[model samples]
Target: MEIVQIFGFALVTLVFAVTLRQQKPEMALIVSLVAGAVIFLLMLRKIGAVVNVFNDLAARANVNLVYLGVVLKIVGIAYIADFGAQICRDAGEGALGAKIEFAAKILILVLAVPVVLAVLDTLMRIIE
Candidate 1:
């Protein structure tokens, strides 16, 4: 059912893209972006389900909830950043998309710094 919904959205977007190409090119780009956003929204429920599973697994493994939350946030950031960059590229703004990607990378690194430091601290303690 989910696959069908995704395919239907893709088909509609393809047709819209083709139709807008001859009339208003800018509209075509907007349609494509909106379509992508709609598809993402449709998949949100599945994403939630996956997150629930991850939570259960983390609990079973006695993992820190903070770590799991941070990892999930990082994944969300990556997904959104990729979506935005792809839309920018589709609109012929490749340079802007590249900048967005670079920003996303920097943000990810910033977010992971505490985790990295903690790991290093643990290693140093073991050495000591």
Candidate 2:
């Protein structure tokens, strides 16, 4: 079912791109972006499933929930950032897209700082 949805989106995107190429180039870009977004929406369920699996594994392993949450947040940031960047690129704002990517990276690093500090504390305790 998921594969079918993905294939359908790809086919539609290809046809749209080819058809719009000569008539309206701007519409082609919009079609491509909408196609990508449609595919992403379809895959969102899969991402949720994977995250659920990770949550279960973390529970069994006694892993820190905060760490898992942070990781998920980072993943979300990356995904949204990429989505925004792609949209910007589609609009021919390549420089703005690059800046968006840089911002995402910085945000991810900031979000990871707490995890890093926790690890450092654990290491210090072990050394002591």
Which candidate tops TM-score? 1
Report RMSD for candidate 2: 1.8
Residue pairs with colliding backbones in model 2 are none
Clashes of each: 0, 0
Q: Write the per-residue lDDT of candidate 2 for residues 1-128, one digit (tens) a residue.
A: 76987898699788879799789988888888888888888889999999999999999999989999999999999999999998899778999999999999999999999999999999999999
On a 0 to 100 scale, what is the lDDT of residue 96 in model 2?
Answer: 100
The lDDT leader among the candidates is 2
Instruction: Give the least accurate 10-residue stretch of model 2, judged by summed lDDT.
Output: 1-10
The local lDDT score (0 to 100) that residue 67 gets in candidate 1 is 83
Residue 44 in model 1: lDDT = 93
- Cα-based TM-score, every candidate: 0.90, 0.88
